[model samples]
Target: MSAIKVNQIRAKLRQLFEAHLDLSDIGPTDGERENKILSRCLAALAIYIQTGCTEKEAAESVWDGGDDNGIDAAYFDPSDLRVVLVQSKWINKGAGEPEAKDIGAFTKGVRDIIEQDNTGFRAGLHAKFSDIALRLSSPGTSVHLVLVSTGASVLAKHGTSVLTTLLKDLNGDDPEPIASSEAMGLAEVYSGLANDPLLSNVSVDATMLDWSYVATPFPAYFGVIDGLQLKTWWKTHGKALVASNIRHSLGSTEVNNEIKQTATSTPEKFWYFNNGITLVSNEALKAPVGAASRAAGVFSFRGASIVNGAQTVSSLAKVDDDNRLAEVRVPLRVILLKSAPAGFGDEVTRTNNLQNRVEPRDFVAQDPEQRRLRQEMAIEGVDYQFVRSEDSMATATSCELIEVTTALACAAGEPNLAVQLKTGIGRFFVDLSKPPYKAVFNAGVSGARAFNAVVVHREIERWIDKKKTSMTKKSGPAWGALVHGNRVLSAAVFAKYGSGNLSQAIASFGAAFDPAVIEAHCDIVHAKMAAGIEANYPGKFLAVLFKNPSMSKNVFDLACA
Candidate 1:
């Protein structure tokens, strides 16, 4: 079976490569063996899968040659600022993984590119050197090492260890990982080929209430669907019901949980509370109930998929009480694509999910405190953008609402508040009149004070980034606490140094504000926090520990001691 599958994949690769790959640059085809040609084709196939680029583009990305380093192919994905480096190993028997030496050579080649040593590379690689270098030099750029193989097994333990060591060395003390690795064996390759859209021509039988149809911009049926009926479809089709949706059902999110709660509790009011579902199909046929009555009717849909309201459908499926579920009525719109223009189905899907999701912070835009802060900050020659939409400007003078909130949370000298912000900042913006929100943005906070706090918070972040580089593996929980519990540490810094007054501290130190003083305070606070971790919360995960109010407070108290 494995051998047959391997042969199938090889045939597919050969078919694809022959159709799209341009082999002119890899020397005369007469001199190359079939295995060697197939190996190069395998690298191009990996690139095509990774980037969704055209087959020609994937083939053009290949740089395999005698002078080529261990890198067989490389493509910079501009969409995510990721440099995808592929090292493909084609094994005819499909039995073994890449050896440790192969892994080492690949890592060394990647290191060479990262270090900007462009010497001794093949002509094909040299052609793309400048573009690759420019992207690698950009901020937020990351390296993805893809070790692709036709082997049945993945990388060995030692090979994995080598990759891990390389990642660690490349990433160093940076908060964001600079490099990561993945080994794609035959199983992965087979799965990619086998994955097809589920239920492409499914037929759904639904009874819709107050049935109505729109015929102007293409035929569309809109009505309310019974929740129980929707659940039945979910049971039958499962994920196939939403295969056309851009985003799958995100299980048990705060919004989804609320959806489940509302469906099970207040079924009648579900229509008013929910945005409802949008389904697209190639055909729709309605059964005639009566000539005078359009109140309710049975409908049949072919090639149907829920392009929107995936969460609603999923949440309804989770409702256990049939009595309550029977009362639930969900609004649904079915778009018929038979007579629609080209790409109409895609446009409908895109537009249905394109609306900006309302967030807790959006409510704060109406708060007078935000307006006051914005005005005051402008008076101080600083741009405080409290409105979420106006936060696109990347000037040094500008600070967004979230940034101000974080800085104020730290400056409040409350470890709990800082920790809360770290865990989930949404709670602080849940209600503008609430404790967390008012606690951070009350009458006492001035423009200068807010600006100063932001300055201090940014400096602490910078300090933490610098501190990360020096951390050894033995740094252990202390290092974890320092990195993960940064907000709590910020609170500790504020508690010790800026407790008197941020304005006074800024006045004393001037606008340039002493980094040396901040660094010293950070050092003291970090050491104390590390000691607290060892003495109070040994072996505890820093991420969870920092979220605990009491644990965070205890650590903060120790740091400020």
Candidate 2:
């Protein structure tokens, strides 16, 4: 997939060179080029969705001037109901990087459509204008909200921290403002080198373009599939494609149904059927060998909510019947496995991988079945506790993550704490990725299980390292190996932007990033958890920058000093 992204970037650059347009005529900085690249890429996707070809098919749109409403171009996929409405802008460099400015625009546009109940440009795809409008705020819905030149890189340092937090909220960050200033300490890498200027300058560098951000990458065109198959695609029914909902990752209920129907989908794992109403494991829903479990998603890869040098999962619940209340915890986790990839060894296990990384995403692109085979082999040697969640999958919510983590306090196993099991990315976050390190049985666990372990593995640091090592090759080693390689890099800065999708802006920046950065962060985060640490925070790293402007320098660099 990464290769595919590079190819797309390369081809775009090659076309520019082939045209031999006087680079001097385009006297704008790299940020301008980043904007163009993103617009063109999105234009290409719109065209492809409409005509099943590249943007060249709709070349005229590239020149169309956009307005405050923000539709640079549009496309209609005649086959399915997919209508692609593109709204993009070349905002203030990286400062605009998926920050409140863009979100405000998007939210306004969607709300206007809803309020007026106006039929947008009619398209030929299976997508309906009403559904598209509804997707504006609904989770488990499919929408490609493309915002180019809106990411933080466009701005100077102050804006970077602010915008980063804005992106986190869209992908499911905690209610608390992020530690924008706290994460500032990480500005070094994204910051930049001498000749390269600040990371802010190259934040829109097309030089690092890749196709994963594209509608479809090499080997497979997921967008095309969804475009053609979405109307009838049950899996993609309530999904959206943004910085967050990239795949058909649904909420707890959808996952629960998936798990229940396919509890026996794989022998090594079980579906965890609820007491008949939902996907919770009861006596009848028991696993033949292992136990059933529910899962959650690692929406943001940054320190979504950090307080006093600690990662805060959530503080949703407070004091329960069992006396376990207050500090909320995410259920994601990645266990160590002997069989990883060709370059994999014991050095890159799930535990080590999640310690420092954010949402590790490499494993997501693999063959689902093959990845499952690997998980079966690996879990064979590990011990697990078979526990069931009190809720069904569909109704499973943040409360579930809290419940599972709290429930695990009573869990125990033969050797190590029983690794509660779930499936897919949802389960993986709750399973091998989140910190609870216990098993849970609920309806959501079943559906996530159906997606198979690859989805789950993709969120794991070890799996991310395997994918990163296989995909990226550099003389220098990764920052945290299993840690920093799997997550996003954010620093606490002077300001923390409100919430929204940052990918569109980053993509428009002719986006190219070290995959290791995303992976390493996920790994580091997972590693930081002790056998029992909570994932809850009520402070913002960027709050300091806003509360006290005296430390502007520290805020810019994201340094605590």
lDDT of 2 by residue, 1-561 (tens): 333433344344335322322223233675566556544443443333323333344443332232323344444332222334444433323233344554455444433332223323333211434344434322222223333332232444544444344445323333222112111111211221111211111110011111112122211100001011111112221111111111112222233333322332331222122111000000111122222211211111110111111111111111111112111111221111112234322232222324432232223323243244224323432111112233423211111232232222212111011111211123333334234331322222321222222112233434444644564432112322222112111211101210121112222211332335435544443233211111221122221212222322222222212
Query: Per-prediction TM-score, please?
Result: 0.63, 0.24
- For model 1, residues 1-561, the per-residue Cα lDDT tens digits are 666777888887777665565566555656555666677778887777665555677787877767667888889865345788888888777778878898888887776676445565765566686477557654446678898888845678899898988787666544435577788888877765564334356679998889898998789999999889988988877666777787656543446657778888788899899898999999988777663577887889999999998888877887888788889999989999999998999999998889887877788878887888788778766788777784355355778888888998998877878977754576687667878899988888877788788878888988987887676532345676665678888988888776555765334434557778888999999989998899887745454466568878998899899
Clashes of 1: 0
lDDT of 1 at 215: 91
Top candidate when judged by TM-score against the true structure:
1
Candidate 1: segments with Cα more than 4 A from true spot: 1-195, 198-202, 215-217, 226-267, 285-296, 310-327, 350-357, 390-396, 472-475, 503-513, 535-539
What TM-score does candidate 1 reach?
A: 0.63
lDDT, residue 425, model 1? 76
Candidate 2: list runs displaced more than 4 Å. Answer: 1-68, 71-87, 90-103, 119-131, 134-146, 150-561
lDDT of 1 at 344: 95
